[model samples]
Target chain A: MTTTNGLPPTGKSARIELVCPAGNLPSLRAAVDNGADSVYIGLRDNTNARNFGGLNFELPAARDGLDYAHRSGTKVLLAINTYPQPATWQRWTRAVDTAAGLGFDAVIIADAGLMRYAVRTHPQLRIHLSVQGSATSYEAINFYHRHFNVRRAVLPRVLSLAQVEQVIRNTPVEIEVFGFGSLCVMVEGRCALSSYVTGESPNMTGACSPAKAVRWEQKASGLEARLNGVLIDRYGANENAAYPTLCKGRFKAGDDVYYAIEEPASLNALELLPELDRIGVAAVKIEGRQRSPAYVAAVTRVWRQALDACAQGTAAPQPRWSEELRRMSEGQSHTLGAYHRPWK
Target chain B: MKLALGPLLYYWPRQSVVRFYEEIARSSVDIVYLGEVICSRRHELRLSDWLDLAAALEAAGKEVVLSTQALTESESDLRTLRRIAGNGRFPVEANDMGAVNVLAGAAPFIAGPHLNVYNPHTLSVLAGLGVRRWVMPVEMPRHVLEDMQHARPAGVETEVLAFGRLPLAFSARCFTARRNNLPKDDCRFSCIDHPDGLPLDTLEGAPFLVLNGIQTQSAHVHCLIADLDDLAGLGVDAVRISPQSRHTADVIALFRQRMIGALDAAAAARELEQLAPGATCDGYWRALPGMTPPGNAP
Candidate 1:
């Protein structure tokens, strides 16, 4: 069968693994019960990238979620993805130990030191390189695999479909691509726009446009979204306001005021399943670990159905799937993200 | 401390690019990094042209290091990267791990700031892969850098971005082209028009970011000319001054004079503020918001 990018099938699994996000126990259950092959979670600290308030798993809830996911035959991966401060380095190392002690399937990590610690200490714990690790090329993926024995890598949302296929074709490590969620216009982990405005960043603080730094002020002109008191965007009365991510917010370039970097659109790659499956992608990851359980269930359900349908020879994404996903998308719309070269 | 010129980030006209290096050869800078670190679509100076310039700069008594693209996206980009990695004459500064992978064990190289070497262990890991020196990620705070300097392995040297607008982020989408309302593939090289990057401002007319093709930079210049003494105390070996469209030579002179104690730190800083395109900030050095000037944040 002909593929989208013209690469012949590698005779891999017809049904790819569907990895889902779980911020808390209910979200974990939502992902697990809704047919996620694997579920990823973060600890309730700055060690992981999704350290939002009222989100992620605390110790007790983590144990319960681990038990539930294991009982449901779904693997649980703990994300220890943020870079550790030199003063607080041990906290991140301890997090890896916590994940291993909890009987977690694997540890998704970004810092090389933590990876070294995991490799030396746990020895048997599978290491999946976080997208925050920024291993965009096959050689880079192979570097982590060679040094730390990293088994799987979630690619940063920068590569085109052909580039993703090139990486998968070249590396022995399992490849995971973002299937659906809010789009990060910049390369993951490499961006510092948030920290540039606010002192906190996803790399250092595990939060981008951290909730505490965000302030909303209603003015006669419009509602202004500010991060650390810097005006990110001002919305009109009838306009749909997106979260004030430094990239997605509107700004002025020359004479025109627009979303100069990127518009507020979520990534929905349901149509690219056949190409992803054809290219031998081991897993398709959904991007919101800080999202609600309902969002998790809704996105996971659509992707799960779509993946299954693709296995059964569905060529295009169903209209209903796109409609359902668009409702849950940020800005009430979705784009194919960097998968399509033109989107770049 | 030695003064190093960072890779020219903007897509200058070929004559302007060549002339910039010719001026650099006579400048007070000790090291010169050549080649594209931003978009691959910029073809005014190809790999051969960079090597020729590197050789010319080397002959002119400056230490030369070749820099790879910060984000490697296409097969053509990879081919250019492979050639840069394999360029036996010069040590390559690895901007991505892909470059690190290709250059590792082949020869010792410089780990560019974009590689995200946050802690000593990550530093040691790259050091193990033959990194001779590492440029600190620009947003890294002072305390973290002090800790890294203390714990750095014996052979590795540390460098900091001492001047120029901070490269805040990189995207697959060409923001410059997007601003011009052109597709990336047919961008018509719009970045050439803005030698200092297309300025992006907030709705209230506050300078926010500068868009240069696929890379975004802080609109405020990050000036640490006054902090050279502090950097020396922290064991920093060198400081990089990114090339701006105008007054780079004067900026280099000010830094050189400060290094030799001929120019007072405060005087040099005041002089640098005049030379920079926009207002100056050293907040990243002080570990505050990157745009905050020291003692100026509300």
Candidate 2:
């Protein structure tokens, strides 16, 4: 059978699906209209990975979004990606029950225990391992598959394209890689820097650089946005300052201060579409459910054009929309990240 | 309660690692987890040496558990993980789920702290898959553990990270190697220079974090000596004292003394602070910011 992204069943030039993040209904529609083959969203609770204010979907909104995506022949994946506490597993269980009841395609999960529960309680529900789970190797992916019968895995961003290719070749599971958005320096599902400073962990609470912990203060030097009482960046009066995630902060390393973990930039690997498709990546994920609908539309449109070009055995098309995307990026900068080994 | 000395989080000389465990064999610790848990580039102690050390510790009447690297970035990492999981000797502590899968149903194992077992259902699932004991995630509070314990399967014992600098996060990029202007692949075992992790100070020169290769830890060493009563009350089966460069054995002794009521909380806390490589904080166990002192508990 042909995969959703329109690649033939040969598996040689595997069809690459464009998976976009939809924090709200507007973004969901934008993604579907612009060419996202599938969209992933989470409920407006701790059950979802993007547990931020003014983001994510309420139950009604989520059900409506799923219905819309389904009508358009686009798949919708529900992310119940946070690790549940002993007293709070029911909240997650209910989320799984809701997703299955609502006729969503799959639930993206991070916790092994929760994965087992989801596979057992909702045996018909397809499972995709969340990138937050930090499955970095064939062994980890195989473990999830053997135990929870996970159908796919959203590979961690740290892996190179070659590594991704190796993982895809070795396992029966479909491999998903981040094609764009904020490059997390730390492993996604396992990081606790935000929680260490703000009493909320990404793994346990499903948030990082959480909105509540962020505060913008005006100083003599410029504007400063701090996260968890630490000044992440101090921009001059005319210079633009990005929202300070801990990793994307300017810090002193010995005598000089620079963006030690990462420059305040997002990943826009538009140039690597053909390579990713050639390497047999089943799907490409765009990070940032916290982004605006316009941002989702622009990114989805550019990637859609590129994917269509790659499918036709043409030179991969470049969407000359970098200026539009720059406005939406963290600090108007971008990188290919570990995919090209630029950092190395 | 049986004590398990967690893997030496820092990179030291191979001889230092051997000597540390040799000394640990004589201490109050019942189990010892040996191997490189931080960056796999640290080859001061090869797998053969780690296996040899595990045998020595086991012969000394302590249970031994070999630990795999927390961040596995290469095929070599997987090969090492497979070897440790298939060693067929002492149990392996599956730090990452990769190791857990390798050890799953092959033999019983210890789920390390990095596995993030925060709830009971997960605990039950792990117990079913041959995990005999599991270490609680560092930031989980006492009450959460109590709730989990109430639902935990009968045979699985619970362990807490009782003492040492709290491991806050691990990354693919090595901060310690980066600081020394080295690539992670060619880190040259730079983390060995910082016996305790390399202290990272804020712009104002306030100590904030400690860099241990790929692992970032709290600069404030976590001391739960004052919480022995609380730990006992929670029915915690073991208190894991992570090894530091200085006075680790003495710190273990202080916990032993406090556990048996030979010392009060005040005395134990004071001794722990004095023996600490830096300032002491138990904020993780208290569910507060990791750097906050007990006096500032919210």
Candidate 3:
């Protein structure tokens, strides 16, 4: 059926794909039921993007998820995004080998050295450049494509639509842009602030704002969480507080205290589907593999419907769904950040 | 070991940029990287101006390397990279892969810290592509660099960002421009106002990070004055000193004295602390958390 926007039904006729995250079995089911043309997941351990507690899939679980998605005519992309440390390249190398041997549709990667290794060893495996690579320009994107034969690039969150269009115009690789998720204020893959405070490199370790160092303490004025002995943020009793990731923390500029880089908000760019499609983005990515199954279902359902409507050229009137998203978000707020000029 | 004065990561006046190099020509620094690294918009020194400065430094018996911008946002940026790569007079420090592609096999070049050359294999690849020197990524521990050095291709000189506020990350969204409520394209060169960098403090007024346009740097200047022996043990060829706003030339002199045993480690460490803009940290060298200053050097 066509959406009010006159877009074709999501799976039936759209050129663009709706890519969703599946951290586990239930999230996998939620993503498929909600309307993901494809779901990306990682094997539990340091091999995946969401290398946190209570998330990710085991090998058997990943195998089941892959088979389930394939049976349902959906795709499964494996994320091997983190760089391999000197002593630990074998772990990442094996993850790539496993993902290739297990029939993943594509394996997303961020490390240049690992990309070279994958291209040389697993020549037939499809490689998608991870956003963590921070390939923001046409030249950067083309460099990866020419060198590694990358089939797609998950564009960094920092690009404007105009820049995205320029990149697509100049490069042959398919483009994937973030559609829903907690937006990173800092450029992904390149940031070392978290590693500075804590010792884990997000690029090498697949963790940022690592939980091992996060300490939530209740004080008389409010609640404070220290990330590596530095007080990242504080929230009053009535205020909703998110996990104090380094870039999202409150800071003082001069006399003013504000979220210097970002406030706690999830990026909901569902309304920009038509703009994204017009820019020739080959796929739309939803960014919460560590979130709950319910979260995955709700977000995936909304965007799947939105993408379907956009394809039919009759996207629904902008839904007043901020309240619904706020309930799903970390700080009870959401934004369309950098995608539109929201900074003024 | 020799010292290379890294590119000025801060915005200094045109005169200050020239004067800093002029001082460096007579100073103990053996190599000087001259160019704008933090933001391409901070154009106090254009290509011609930088080349002129490079020529002056070269004339005064110093090796010069032109550094490419760590973050390239436009076609104009690629043009700049191409120009620097083809300059023919001096080596180029390939900060990003775009520059790497342009410089690969053309000539021997220095791979700057941001290229993320974490291991021997990556170094081997770049070495094959003609990287004559590779700067250690800012936070790599001493042991990791030692391991990589052992397996490094011969003639691949290793340089470490031994001093400076470590450049943590670079972005297309300019934080310094955003602080002024300006779009990156119309930044109006606001980063120039803060000659060192715009210091970002925690809500409680703790110094955290310094914002330099698109680049984010550490609040604490990374000082390896006390760890020179360890670095030399790793066979590091050169220690890169990033230029700060004040007392940079003095800091270079102190580093030279310490490296040559003219000053003891304790005296050098004390001098470094006195000269720093803020607290000093060398945890990256020790493999502890980068913000933690190790109590004693190994």
Where's the lowest-lDDT run of ten residues in candidate 2 chain B?
A: B200-209
* Candidate achieving the largest lDDT: 1
lDDT of 3 by residue, B2-74 (tens): 8989998888889988887888888989999988776767778899999999999999989999999887656
Candidate 1 lDDT, B128-233, residue by residue in tens? 8899999999999899999998999999999999999999998889998888889999999999999999999999999999999999999999988888999999
Clashing pairs in 2: A132-A189, A195-A200
| Model 2, span A167-223: residue lDDT tens | 877889998999888888777776777766777888877878788788998977778
Task: Identify the runs in model 2 with alpha carbons over 4 angstroms from their true place.
Answer: A1-13, A317-324, A342-344
Better of 1 and 2 by DockQ: 1
Error of 2 at B4 (Å): 2.1
| lDDT per residue as tens, model 2, B177-201 | 7777777667777788888877766
In order, what lDDT does every prediction score? Answer: 0.91, 0.82, 0.83
How far off is residue B48 in model 2, in Å? 1.3
**Docking quality (DockQ) of candidate 1:** 0.84
TM-score of predicted structure 2, chain A? 0.93
Model 1 lDDT at residue B233? 93
| C-alpha-based local distance difference test score of model 2 | 0.82
DockQ scores for all predicted structures: 0.84, 0.59, 0.53
